[model samples]
Target: MNREERIRSLLDRIRSASLDAHGFVTELELQDFRKNLLVQRGVGMSLLMASECVVQLEAFSPDFVAEHPEIPWAMIRGMRNRMAHGYFDIDLNYVFQTAKHEVPDLVRIVETLLHIHPQGE
Candidate 1:
C-alpha cells in the first residue's frame, strides 16, 4: 500500500481492535474483570490485539501518530511490546484499565483521523 493507503489501512485495523476491546471492557466492572479468569483472558487478549494494531500502525509511519497527539501512541506501543516480550509478567489489571479507559479515546481519535485524512490523502 502507498503511504495514505497504509495509514488508512492501519487506522481501520486500529479501529476494529479498539472497538473489540472497548466492547469487551465496557460490559464488566473491575471487580468482575479481576475475579474471573475467563474475563481476565478475554480482556487481556483484546487489549493485546488492540495494542498490536497500534504498534503496526506506528511501524507504517510514526508521523501519522505524531501528528495526532490525542492518541496515546507511546502507551499503545508500550503495552504491545511489553505484552509480546514479557507475556507472563503482564498485569491483567493494567490491560483491563487500558481497555476501559484508553480504548474509548482511541476509537474516537482514530475515527476522527479517518475522516480528517480520508483514504489516499
Candidate 2:
C-alpha cells in the first residue's frame, strides 16, 4: 500500500476500534466498567488498537496529520504511549470516560474524514 492507501487503512482501523470501544460501554456505566475486569480489558484493548492506528498514521508526514484537525491525533498517540508504558499507573476513570464518550465522536470524525477525502484523493 502507498501513502494514501496506508492512511485510509489506518483510518478504517481506527474507526473499527473506536466503535468497538464504544460498544463495550453501551449497556454499562462507569461503575460497571470499574468492577468488570473483562469489560475493562475489552475497552482498554480497543483503545489501544485505536491509538496504535494513530501512532502509525502519525508516523507519516506532519502535514498529512495536520490536514485533519478534527481528530485528536496527539491525544490518541499519547494514550497509546500511556497504555503501553504506564502499565501500573493506567487511569481506569479516564479510560472509561474516553471509551464511553470520545470514542463515538472519534468514530464520527473519522467517518466524516473518510467520506470527505474519499479513497486515493
Off by over 4 Å in 1: none
Q: Quote the RMSD, in angstroms, for model 1.
A: 1.9
Q: Per-residue CA lDDT of candidate 2, range 42-65, in tens? A: 999999998998888888756778
- Candidate 1, which ten residues in sequence have the lowest lDDT sum? 38-47
- The candidate scoring highest on lDDT is 2
Relative to the true structure, how large is the alpha-carbon lDDT of every model?
0.79, 0.88
Model 1 alpha-carbon miss at residue 66, Å: 2.2
- Measured by TM-score, how close is model 1 to the native structure? 0.85
Strongest candidate by TM-score: 2
Flag clash pairs in model 2. none
